[model samples]
Each structure stands twice: as structure tokens, then as C-alpha cells.
Target: MTSRSRHTAAALALLTLAVACSTGDGAPAAAPSGPPASGRAAKDVHVAFVGAAANLNFSQEMMEGAKYAGQELGADVQVVAPPGPDGQAEVGLFQQVVATAKDGVSVMTLNPELFTRPAADAIAKGVPVVAADVPLAKDSGVTTLVSNDNPAAGAMLADAVLTRLPAGKKGTIVLGVPTPGLPVLEARLKGMKERLLAKNPGLEVLGPFDSKQAPDDNYKAWSGLVRAHSGALAFLDAGDPAAFNLPKIKQETSASWLCAAFDLNDAGLAAIKSGQSVGVADPQHWLKGYVATRLLIERALGKREIPKGFWDSGAAMVTEDNVDEVIARQKGPEARAAWYKKLIDEQFADVQGRMKPLS
Candidate 1:
């Protein structure tokens, strides 16, 4: 549809949706309509991601992107997260803001399924929602998902390990997994497992050994698995204890064992460069945040537009060969985001081509 048509549809939806004002009744209440009272992103314009406001998940980078966009747009953007990583909490926080928050929203998925209903609810309440990281249901009214093809990412991360394996050689590979039941991680593991086994029939994939979402628990889980699964050729992980914390734990236990995970932290990158671990998959965290804010702001103000499908944020693998290049890009927050944008334009040509320049 044309921009004018889309905007008209959005405006009608906004004014017509049931607005639960102070009375909590499903009636149109005196909610703030259209844009900030004064600027692009005034205090009234709140945007939230998945993790808590304080936790050091990828949301930190996302928040940074929000801040960057807010500053550029001359708006005061409020960044918040659910109290925990749980989807219910995320939806709860979303509902809380639905009544009070004006302007746009972006939510990274902990559980995309649960998000569909709440996302529809938010849309009904006239808030344009952007699904970042994990995608909402295909039918959900919310369009513009700024995320990766997670299972594809998993298969990609798996290739990092698969290539290094001696030709025609296959053995047991251990998986250090983050907490259970997250859709994104599950897809990652699925991709990793399918590819790893497909390449070498003799290869055995074992234990998405729970990382438990804590440094200590993750270390314990991985270490215990390693000790039990001796002769394991390589250890692989999409993230969590597998990504950020496993480096130190692996060093302490079995430095020679090949390991891989997705995403990165300072220590994880160092491990990759030093060759303690195989590699870390780059999820393009900065881009997810940047694109999310860009989408939310545009849709809120009736400017930018995207098709029904997800804007795959794309992924990359940082191995020993490219470790230095990745390190330079990650020197600081700005550097990290800048590097990703460069790659996004180069690698995700379709997204870049379609993304309307938010002037």
C-alpha cells in the first residue's frame, strides 16, 4: 500500500481502537494521540525491549541504539525492559504502558507466540509495535520485524565448527545451551544440530546442556558436561554460558577442546582471537536496536514503511581469521553500531534497499 493509505489506515485504527483510559473500561479514553506533545521523542514516548532496563543482555546495545535515535530525533526516549526475560512479564509491562505510553514501541521476543495476542492488543490500543530479535506470529497485525533468521543463524554458527572438523572425521559434539524454552535459541540449536549431523553421519550431537542463565550455573553445566563427555571433539553453543562465560570456564577446564557460541562479550572475543574458542556468531545486536527504533519512530509519526515479512537483521561469524577486524569494530558502542551498519548495507542488500531513509 502507498504511504498515504498506510498512514490513513493506521490513524483510523488508532482512533477507533478501544482505549482503556483511567477507568480501565474497554472504551476510547483520553489517551494522547499522535507524536510527542513537543518533540520527536518526548518523555511521553516510551520504547521497551525484552530484558530488564539494567541487565547486560544484547538489549544494552539496543538501548544504546534507541538513545542514539532519540538524540538525533530531538526526543526523550524512555527505554525499559520486562523485570525478567520471561514473555509474560514482557507482555505485562507492555500492557501497563499501553494505557499511559504515547507514541511508538519495540519489543524483542522472549516468546513470540505469547507476544501475538498482546501485540494485537497494543495495536488495538493504537500503539504501533515492532518485533525485534524474535518475530511475532505471521498473522499478527504488527509488521516490521527487525530480527535474524535464527535457525539460519544457528546453521551458520554450526558451520564455523563443521568446517574446522577434519575431513571425513566426526565425533561427539557437545552443545552448551542457554535456559530452555526460548524460541530463538531453540531455532539456533535446531539449525546447528541438523547441519552438524548432516555433514558427518558419524557425528553425534549431545546435551543442549542447560546454562541456566547465570555465570556460575553455566560454568557448572558446561564443566560437568565436558568431564562426563570426554573425547567430545568440539563443544558448540548458540549463546549464553556457551558464548560469553564459557571462555574462562573452558580455559580453566580444557583449553584444547574446540568450542563455539553465538554473540560476544569482551572476554568471549578475546578467547576467539586467542583461539581458545572456535568463534562467536555476531547477531547484529546494534542493528536490531537501531532498526527497531527507526521503525517505531517512523510508524509512530507516519513516515517509514515496511512489508509484512521480517526485515532479517542478518548474522556473521567471527573466527580467528577475522577476529581482529571484529575487535576493531567493537572498540566502543558507536564503533560497534557503525561497523554493523556498514555490514548491514553490504550483506543485507534487500533490507537496506527497502529501508526508507528516516531523515
Candidate 2:
């Protein structure tokens, strides 16, 4: 098999393992004593979670959170994903889920525009839809979005990198995105560039290069970039691929340039702990999943209207000092939920007041 094929196979294998581990006995969790508009118990409410890609670590983490919320709230949560970042496949899956899901659907996609009609159709049919990770357009008929502030995350990453470099450093700092033209990724790159440039006018920012999404291709893209810019002061990425791949490339070449990115995978956490990366900006994928699912469940149970606009899921910078704690929290769904309990409770208590305009 070609290297890309091998990488795809490995990623699919990991995804399979994750799904297998997450699957439980077909029995539903006990429902709270309440009936929805359909006169069904809360446990009978079905919530569909549609993810952009099956192989991404952050996406898997989001699925875990979705399942955890399902178990906690006694909702039937079904998670699905395309094999890769195929926008058409994701849109098709969203439509299918909306058609069959009895209560609500939560979708995370790179191409929100493609989902506009499908989402509106679902909402028109009384199946509430909420956007997760990627915010949908206002005209999409999706009322709420659960996501971290991408621009803020980018600025946070830039600040982390700046802490390592001397004042007014003149060398280049390269930026990359696994999927070019993605708004969330672009927002991060924009935030990083603005912050880095604002802080150090002498520093030269390089391309927000097109780093491919798949693992092997991502490594090759970053590897070539690093080789081409051997004298770069630091390297930053807007996607999880670089969080895993850049450190490997850095070690292989014994490159001095600091490396960092957004999102957490095992490799990314290890890189931070081992000092291969300056730090990683975590967009809190698990929280996004949990909140989105929880919101749908609440709506299904008639607890409240699904709040409109953006619900900030929050973000954090993971460094060596906190990498162990972050690693511990990622041990399992229960651990993650427990770590986020206070934040979750606070946010859910006043979702309407807490929400911001999508702009």
C-alpha cells in the first residue's frame, strides 16, 4: 500500500477501536420522569451527532462527549462521520440523520454552507438542529452553535509561542492549516498572525500553508515546509494534524524551531510534555460535543428553547506545567466530564445570556 493508504488504514483502525470501546449494551439509560411532546420518555429521545471526519482525534473526543451526555441525560445519541473530510459525504449524513432522528441533530462540518438547506428543512420538520465545532451561517436555520472562539485560540497560541522567543525576534514563524479555506482554521491563522505581528513587528510570518488533512500527507506537507524554512523561529498550525506531525518532523531533523498547534491528540500531548512543542491551544472539543448534545436533549424534553447564536465552549493553552493534568482529564469520558463539570453547570445555567452573536 502507498504511505497515504497505510495512514488511512491506521486511522480507520483506530476509529473502529474507539467506536467498539464506546458501544455499550443496547439498553437505554433510565429516563427522568418526564414526557416529551411526542409523549415518549426522555430516554426515548434520539439525538444524532454528525461529525466532519471519522479519523480526527478531536472529532473522536467530541463523540465521546456526545455519548457521555447521552448516558447522563438518558437520551439516545447516535454518532456518525464521513471516512474523511468530504463535505458532500458529511452533508449527506446530516440529511439522513435529520430524516430519521426523532428529536434533534447536532452537526459539525467544515462546509456549513452546504448544510444550510438540509438544516433548515430539518428544523422546518420539527427536528431541532444545532451546529457544533463549526458555526453555521445565520440564514442556515440552525439556531445555536457550540464551539470555542477560534480567533481567541489563535491569539492564545501566538502568545504561547511569543513567550519562548526573544523580544523583536526577526526570524520567520510559519503557519499551516490541514484544510485550507476552512473558516475556523483560517480564523485561528488570522488571530495568530495578527497577534504575532502586533507583538513583534520584526518577525516575518510565513504562509498559512495548505497542510493536507490525512496523517501521512500532513507530515509530508509540514516536513517539506520545515525543510524549506530551516531558519524559522517557530512553527504553528491551526489544525490537529500538525499537533501530532510537527513534533515528529522536528525530532527527525533535530530542528530548533519551536512547534505548536491547536487541539489535542496523544502525540500532541506527548509533544508538549516532552518539550518538542511550545504548547498547544486546546479548543475543548469534548465540551463542544457535550454542550451541543445536552442542548438538544433539553430541547427535546421541553426544558427550554435551544438558545440562538454562539455558545462559547471555551479554550485553554496546554503546556508542560499542565500537560499532565490535561492528559489525566483525557483518560476517559467520565474524567473529562468531571473536569468540566463546574464550567458546564455555569454555562448551562444561563445559556441565553452567555451566548454571543455569530459575527
| Top candidate by TM-score | 2
Q: How close is candidate 1 to the true structure, as a TM-score?
A: 0.78
C-alpha TM-score for every candidate: 0.78, 0.89
| Runs with alpha carbons beyond 4 Å of true place in candidate 2 | 1-39
Q: Per-residue alpha-carbon lDDT of model 2 for 1-359, expressed as tens digits?
A: 77655554454334422111222452223233333444456666788888888888878878777877777766778787777787776776676667667688898887888988888888889898888888787777877888888898999999999989988878899999988888889999999999999999999999989988888899999989988999899989999889989999999998888999988899989988888999899999988888898878777766666778889989999999899999999998778878988888778666678999877
Q: In candidate 2, where is summed lDDT lowest over 10 consecutive residues? A: 14-23
Against the reference, the lDDT scores of all candidates come to: 0.65, 0.82
- The residue-level lDDT of candidate 1 at 30 comes to 18
Worst 10 residues of 1 by lDDT: 19-28
Query: Whole-model lDDT, candidate 1?
Result: 0.65
